[model samples]
Target: MSIISSTSHATSNTATLSQRLTAAIGASILGACLVYFAGFSHIEAVHNAAHDTRHSAAFPCH
Candidate 1:
């Protein structure tokens, strides 16, 4: 395998399911919090999402 392919395969074949899930969930929550607290940083993109357009929950997004 090429270096990139081998590195990708190794990374994809990690040992623990829960560990990976925890990492992914942690990253997502961190990202969401950053976006939530970034103060107008992503307003345009949020405004462009379908949920923000049609089914917005009672958050300050709209």
Candidate 2:
């Protein structure tokens, strides 16, 4: 009986871990899509923004 109960508990834990992993991966894909669209939609704007940011951070762009 004790072994059965422990096995059930482990199965539940595995299910929970899998669900969390799926959610995390979905969120990451969604975020990547958003960034890709935003950056690619206006290439010039994104490049200018990044250039300004680098200057602000004192990074030598030249």
Q: TM-score for every candidate vs. truth?
A: 0.40, 0.45
Each model's lDDT comes to: 0.65, 0.75
For model 1, state the Cα shift of residue 60 in Å. Answer: 17
- For all candidates, the clash counts are 0, 0
Question: lDDT, candidate 1, residue 30?
Answer: 97
Shift in Å, residue 28, candidate 1: 0.6
User: Clashing residue pairs in candidate 2, if any?
Assistant: none
Model 2: per-residue Cα lDDT over 1-62, one tens digit each:
35554444444435588899999999999999866665456678876776687789998978
> What does the lDDT come to for candidate 2?
0.75
Candidate 2 deviant stretches above 4 angstroms: 1-15, 42-62
Best by TM-score: 2
| Residue 3 error, candidate 1, Å | 31
